[model samples]
Target: MSKPVLIAGPTASGKSALALALAQKTGGVVINTDSMQVYRDLHIITARPTPDEEAVVPHRLYGHVDAAVNFSAGAWVTDAAKVLADARAQGRLPIFAGGSGLYFKALTRGLSAVPPIAAEVREDVRARLERDGVEALHAELAVRDPASADRLKPRDRTRIARALEVVEATGRSLTDWHREGLPPLLPPGEFAALFIAPERDALYARIDARFDAMLAGGALDEVASLASRNLDPLLPAMKAHGVPALIRHLKGEITREAAAETGRADTRHYAKRQFTWFRHQLPEFEWVMPGDARGWVASVIPGREANPESRDSGSGPSDHPGMTWS
Candidate 1:
């Protein structure tokens, strides 16, 4: 694998900007890892880079999905592998960038061997949950797979239901399949990845401000355009962070102001969750301030060495706080 610079951070953290800078410097391809940005009609709302910015540097996997399909991290990693392979074959660096933590994790650590649930099984589980309530499903899951149930909150219907549904359809617990040992996708030795850890209060302010800007920039109209297409509301694309609230506003179910406020709040909450996930699950990534893109990137990639202490023989980070400077 060719060395790829991963520019990751919370929402509104200038990850895309940093990625473009690195791409321009290194003749790389900027691959989108954000789950929302994959939705085709969500360019402005997902803040997909402008054409001029894209023209300055090649980008892959942004605004390419129809809202009807639920795009998964597993699917994203598969797509990203092709982009990375292409970039390497062309002797160009691959710039992996986005706020979606799962996509990045899948790219680095690989996903579990969980099969896609059959449509009927999925619909049946969803209907059962809706009819029987979260607690009922929670108890059932506890009886079936106590490990996953213990880890999940009883009210975290999104995941708890998924765990139960997987067990029901596959006749194997999701946790059991997870332990079945899937092979690495990229493996740790392949590339350099970074996680941008911004100060919390500042990140919140940026989140609120960006949501306002997104609204001013026709996020409502974008959602309206998507809604006009009549894509299933339950689809992952339609349920993107700001899409639901904006769609509600468009449907006259909520005032525009209320919708925007809820969207901003949701983004802020998601940013918090993203940080927690990265810090806890993937501590191997070098943490960097977004402002030092050029120097930090130069320090880690290829021949240049920034911090002698963190670098290894192959491309991997040390058990420390900065880039590997081989």
Candidate 2:
């Protein structure tokens, strides 16, 4: 089998389409590297691969976790390890695709060996965060784990609470845990990595349009169901690109148009961050334009002759409606 493929890009940059095409051509399994797409409640809001698209090929780690779980990159690694083993045992090439920089980083570069914090400790930190606020928590963290407090922003509720939880659960600071990290799963040379880089204006346009499309595609309803659960606001699923804004709309806190605009703007900003993160944090990824991605994949992937149709102006299999491999 050919080397596994790693596809990373900003939201709505067509990374999913390229991955689906490659998986179809190589009989590979597409594993989700996106953080939001893992939550079952975020299928629409997160632009996760639809059930129909998933039916076309093997997909792992999509919509498998509940919205209540504060799923971490470390948790994803544990889950991904099993999926990777299963793919290798079945002799299927593995294609990791998504825009999550941390997940991709954890896959290629080792992650810190932080043990899971006990549920009570996590709940206590979260409760204290709600009662005492993030600044107070940051102050506490500064007293407990000075390095982590200094490293993390004062208002970064998630990281601040996490660091406090680590210190509370284990006497060691997060910095000490980072000194010992788990090895990368794929390692260097085991996978061919590509970051789909679309032109800035074009990418922003697509992100705005995709956000509108997602809203029409029952994203608001999905968010409503999730909000009804009254899950912790700090949970990753609750913080998905459009989820918070849509939840506000559902609660009549904003107009539908206002919510859409906020969601679109948030997504656009996130896309910009994704580009920066992949460029600086994961420099090894060869950046390819969306239109050129198929050709690049065709050249790197083996087993079948490079499909000329992929290089043509004609359409190819789409991972979702309005998304296609160019």
Candidate 3:
């Protein structure tokens, strides 16, 4: 069987395009590794593959969950394991693609086995954090779960609240559950992975242009519908890169122009963070610039030509011999 392909990159870095091209050539199925794209309500805002793209190649796990659901990395890993097995059984390559570093990491490495916390528990912790402030919560965590407190910053409201919730709900520190993690779905030496790295300035330009295009493509209406639902503001979908800003505009807190600018800035900052996270957390993935990714992927897959015409032109495989796929 061919090795499964994993394509990870920052937003607007052409990850989906690369996945689609390779899948078309290899008879593969594209599986989503993006956190935002999983929401059914976020098709346009998340830049999900359109129906036309999905019709070209088999796609799995895209827009499968509701925006109100608190989908976690562990949940995605479980879903992905089933999809990976089905694809392998059918003799099709599984092309995992997206920019969510944590989701990708969970697939390639084991994830913490923290059990689900009740909605009430999560809401209570969030409420306490808001009422008593993060520092107060940090102090409480320091007393209850000092191990977590010592590792978390006082200003880290999310982590602080999470630690408190786990301790409160399960009577164990978050670090304890982390020590007992689920095995990796795709362990080392089992998959071929690549991270797309584009020129910083060019990437920023694409991000800006894409945000403008999203605004034109009814992203505002999408956010407006989501805002009307009165879902929890802390849900991941609610805080998607542009959602909060667009919601602010809908609430008359900001002008449309200002919302668009804020969304653009937020996406650029997120792209920068993705670059850093993947570099530091997933060092094993081979990094290729946008122009070279297609050649790099083709080179790693057996019986595939990087460029068919080059075979007769007296040119050899693209000079990316440093990367090896097992």
Candidate 4:
């Protein structure tokens, strides 16, 4: 079985650069495992590899979807499987890189066979999510499936809503389906993995600086362009880190500074969660400083270089922090 090297870490930790260097040396194909970068319209805000970066290496699944469409973890996993198959078939090494931990988990361990909820079920859950707080929804979920509730916090609206939706739709608990035994697509020993970790203070600094850089690097303009489309304010794209604040700013409801502050705070919180996820959920990955990634690559990759075509664009599907939906 062919397995790819997976590189994951908190945002702005330089994981992407390491992946590039490793891919360049290994001749691997960079496949995006990030949910945000999949949307073609989110290029700048998502920090997709720029045109110059993509030109330097071969990248797959970058900007393949329209921003208007909502994408699920299941969809991302399906797309990722295809990307892996294609890369392997072409005799190319596959490099999976992203900040989305759930995506990685879903790919490595097949998702629970709990199928998608019916539309009616989804609407019912959504109504509950709106009328009652996520805590209340989670409380209901806890009553239905105590085991699942035990594993999740009350504020984890996305999972809580999903779990409840599944129970309502199929009369089965999400946790029970998980207990039904889903095996790993590639066994643990089949691949090498790395999680880039910058020092805490430094990581926060980088997150701040990166957000500022993103604003200066046309992220605001990207938001402006998206705002012009007049899409639903509740759409996933509209809710991305800087997108909501920018929308509020554009609506004259808040000052640019206020929006920036909120955006920065949100990003920081997200980075914190990411660090926690990599530390706890992905214990098997080698945790190394971004500066040490080249060494890890040298030790594990054995001199491989992905084609230069994919690196021209500094942005790709896997370039951003892909978050789950509410």
Candidate 5:
């Protein structure tokens, strides 16, 4: 059997198409590694694979989560472990793909074994964050868990609140929890990983074009539906690249054009960050330019022929009907 493949890159980098191609060749399962793509309510906005594409090959974890759930990397890791095991048991290669660097990191480098904070505790902390302001929480955390506070930026509302909640709910600092991290699901040498490096000008153009395409593809309607549900604004689904901007557009807070531009800009920025993150945090992944990615894959996997119909050389989005890159 071929080693499991981990295809990760910035959004719209065609990682999904590459994974699908590999799965077709190796009879593998395509596993989701993107955080936003997990939400059931964020199909168009998150650029999740379409029903038709998913029907072409077995996919795990895409759109399996509710928008309201505060899903985390740890939760994803847990889900992925099961999916990986099932794929192996069925004698299928495991193809992981997405732009979530943290998910990839957790999959390959282990994650802090912080137990789930109770819903009540999480809500209380979030409420306090809104009411007391992040600075106040930072001060409180400094007193209670100085190590965590010192490590976190004062303005980082999410991590600060999380650290405070962990301490409040478990009487342990996040630092202490980090010491007892869960081992990686795919440890070193067990997987062949690659980061698709796209040219900046071309990538930005694709990001811009894809944003408009998503708008034309009913992304606004999708966001409208999600916004009507009145989910917490801090929820991951609510904060998806296009969701917040489109929500503001729905509220008459911004024009649709402005919202689209904002979403495109945000996505572009996120793509840049993904490049930096994988370079620094997951250096184990071989960085290959998009045009060279297929060759890299064939070279790594050995003896697999390139799919004749898979026309995406990673210059942009895949034209393959069975693939949609997030």
Candidate 6:
């Protein structure tokens, strides 16, 4: 079986384009590792591949879950395991592509096996957080589970609530459960991973241009439709990069120009965060500039040329002597 190719990069870094090109060349199936792209309701806003793009190659796990469900990393792992198995059985290369660092980490490094938090307990903790604020929750956690509280910041509402819920429901600290984690789906040296590291200015320009294109392509309409559903504000889909600002625009709280600006800023910030996260969290992934990415992949995967005309054109990795691979 061919070693799976995992392409990770920030938003607007051409991850999808590279995945599609590789998939076309290697008879591979592209798998979604992005957290937002899983929601069926978010197409334009999430920058999910259009139907035409999907038709180019076999794609799995995109827009498969309802936005109402609180899809977790664990759930994504479970779904991805099945898809990976199928790809291996069919003798097709699995190309995992996306910007979600946590999802990638969960796949490569095992995730903590924290049991499900009861709905009532979860709701109660969230309600308390809403009423008493995150500081109060942190104080409570400090009294109940000092170790977790020490590890978590006071302003971290999500982690604070989760730690509190775990302690309340199971009488065990979150750290205790975290000590035992599920085994990694793809262990070290079993797969080839690459992180695209484009020049920051160029990437930021691309992100801004992409957001404008998305707005022109009816991102506002998509957000309006999703907002009409009145799902919980805390839901991941509701807080997607552009969704919140667009929803504010829909509510007349912000002008369209302001909303667009906010969306672009948020996306740029997210892309920056993705770069830092992948660098620090998954250091094993080799970083390559945009122009060199295709050539790098071609080198790692035997019999796969970076471009069909490269040999004739004499413009391959051999020509660019500065290409870095570690």
lDDT of each: 0.77, 0.86, 0.86, 0.75, 0.87, 0.86
lDDT-superior candidate, 3 or 4: 3
Alpha-carbon TM-score of each model against the true structure: 0.85, 0.94, 0.91, 0.83, 0.93, 0.91
Best by TM-score: 2
lDDT for predicted candidate 5 compared with the true structure: 0.87
Write the residue-wise lDDT of candidate 1 on 8-64 in tens digits. Answer: 888877787777665655566789989999988888888888777777667899887
272 in model 2: Cα distance from truth in Å? 0.6
- In model 2, which range of ten residues has the least summed lDDT? 306-315
Error of 5 at 289 (Å): 1.0
Clash counts per candidate, in order, are 1, 0, 0, 38, 0, 0
Prediction 1 global C-alpha lDDT = 0.77
Where does candidate 5 stray beyond 4 Å?
304-326
lDDT winner between 5 and 6, please give it: 5
Query: For candidate 4, what is the TM-score?
Result: 0.83
Better of 1 and 4 by lDDT: 1
Instruction: Enumerate residue pairs that collide in model 6.
Output: none
Query: Which pairs in model 3 have colliding backbones?
Result: none
The predicted structure with the larger TM-score, 2 or 3, is: 2
Q: Which should have the higher lDDT, number 2 or number 6?
A: 2
| 1-326: candidate 6 lDDT, tens digit per residue | 66899999999888887887777666678999999999999999888888877876679999999988778898999999999999998778899999999999999998999887778888888889999999999999999999989998889877888899999999999889889999999999889999989889988998888899999999999999999999877778888998999999999999999999999999999999999999899999999898889887887797653333222322112211233222
Which pairs clash in model 2? none
Q: What is candidate 4's lDDT per residue for 1-326, written digit by digit as tens?
A: 23578888887777666666556655577777777888898997877777766765678888998876656777777777788878888777788888888878886766766676667777778777888889898888889988888889879777787788888998989877877754555567878888888788987877788788888888888898998997744446777888999888988999988988888889889889988887888788889876667677666755344355534433332332321001
